[model samples]
Target: MRQSACINTLIRRRDNASEPKITDSISPKEASPTLSRLGFLVALGFLRLTSVLPLRLLHWIGGGLGWLFAVIPNRSAATTRRNIAACFPALSSAEQESLARQSLKGMVCTGLEMGKAWILPIEGTLAQVTEVEGLAALQAAAKAGEGVILLAPHLGNWEIFGYFVCEGIASNFMYQPPKNPQMDALLRGVRAKSGIQLAPTNRKGVAILLGALQKGELVGVLPDQVPTDEGGVYADFFGESAFTMTLTSRLAQRGTPRVFCGFAQRLPKGKGFKVIVHEADAGIYDKDLGASAAAINRSVERCVRLAPEQYQWEYKRFRRQPDDSEFY
Candidate 1:
């Protein structure tokens, strides 16, 4: 009887409160943008700090973050755990737990190293690339005087992949400019520091890419990013149909550009990053879009296999899907 009475009183209160109000407590347009700018400044400051800090110090901080995330019972983390679980089910519970721990550590370390990756010398970072194979293959592909397309997956220190191409291969790339204008200038400056031009992800950006191709240049891009709903097609990613950006395929089909698969595998400890390179697999340029996508994904798979620990396993890879599926 007491519970029923409480419920009735709550319902009455909610009904009365349904009427809206107009007050200063609601609008925050001016403050919102200002706060965002403040966040950008803080984020850049931290990036700068992390770049100079010793790798050991970053790992110590990263370990604490990993431990905290490992214990959390949450959505994004849990979903990533599930995806990883599917990839290596043969492991014991303890092994899976270790991977989860490492995933967080890898993520934190990457975050810590972003500033160095963006601004550090290419000669310094690419030293970790122990070996370079298939230079002749790359040269052969470029013989047609067409622009080369380099696709980096989420398998490694992707930041350095752009740097390697820009410095080693003389490539340029299109970038999604940061939403915050303050950071936009910073990113544009760093990404282009090696003399590679950064194209915007807009109509003009496509024109820039095509023009580069016509002039026999190289273009690098990360093909694993989620696309706008209107433009994406469902592609199989690690045994799941993920909404992958079709930009890679569309570009290859458009210009028949030679596509080389590359990724910067993050090394153990603070040893820096490595760039793994491979020729696109067969069927990547097939008339069948599905075949092409699968071939491209297979190429990415090879990059991932080069160093599984460095892969970005914690990313919201399968967040979007067709229909209303809660399996994620």
Candidate 2:
């Protein structure tokens, strides 16, 4: 009853709020043709340069950049601190600060390493995964001809995880295109190189995901992203009310697919990454949308706890509060 009431209140607040609905479908900002082309060329050049450097060098550089972010007065740093403090209230202020710094470092490190994941040969990228913790579960589901819905949260290097899964299974990954058309095209080409189908985050995309699941193929969703008000519900995340997406729950209930949560943990000293997969919280399969949304958050929390410092704490995960108050 409490959960139901809370959700109802949240829904009412959202309905009455004046803010425009947030979505990923906004068109790219208008830019001059020449400038857009130049920008794309520069971005492509940077990717090519970074993709060739050793991972150790990239991490070393990223660490310095991340330290700057922690020390400087910036939105990312402030947001990271706020998120860490809220999610881990038991930690001392000093400890929270330290974790915030480390989290920034990890986040930057992952960004710098994206070249390796997206530009390098798929075989080479796969080799960087030194170990995989749970492959049998996925294999078992595939063997049984059951559809699998893998939830990869914003923990660790998710891009690497996507590549690894696409290579290992017949997979369809749901993604929202960037506002930059050139970047979107580049990323779409890079990701589809591994034989994985890319599903846009729209009605067509959802249909694509459903079709893939129905065919007993694997589908991946970034479960931590905030959906528009119409597509989400309020749920408790780390003891705070968070606007959680209902898509995962709807998919689970509608398709009856076997759900799993996983992430790629960046190993220390630039060694490599560890792909860890596990079953999602049992409540994710519950019929109640509120219970299922809460379960989605719980599953993400479980993954984040494995590598708290590596989680993407910089994102404003709790921006939509239950009382319609500002959180960031």
lDDT of each: 0.66, 0.80
C-alpha lDDT of residue 166 in model 2 = 58
Q: What is the model-wide C-alpha lDDT for candidate 1?
A: 0.66
Error of model 1, residue 277, in angstroms: 0.7
Tens digits of per-residue lDDT, candidate 2, 265-298, equal 9888878999999899989989999999999999
- How many steric clashes between backbone atoms does each model show? 1, 0
lDDT, model 2, position 284: 90
Top TM-score prediction, candidate number: 2
Give the root-mean-square deviation of each candidate in angstroms: 10.1, 9.0
Candidate 1 lDDT at 289 equals 70
What's the lDDT of the predicted structure labeled candidate 2? 0.80
Kindly give the stretch of ten consecutive residues in candidate 2 with the minimal lDDT sum. Answer: 1-10
Cα deviation at 17, candidate 1, in Å, is 26
Candidate 2 colliding pairs: none
Q: Give the TM-score (vs. native) of candidate 2.
A: 0.89
Model 1, 184-264: lDDT tens digits are 677677766677777777778877877787677887777766778765677676677777666677677776688898776
Report the number of backbone clashes for model 2.
Answer: 0
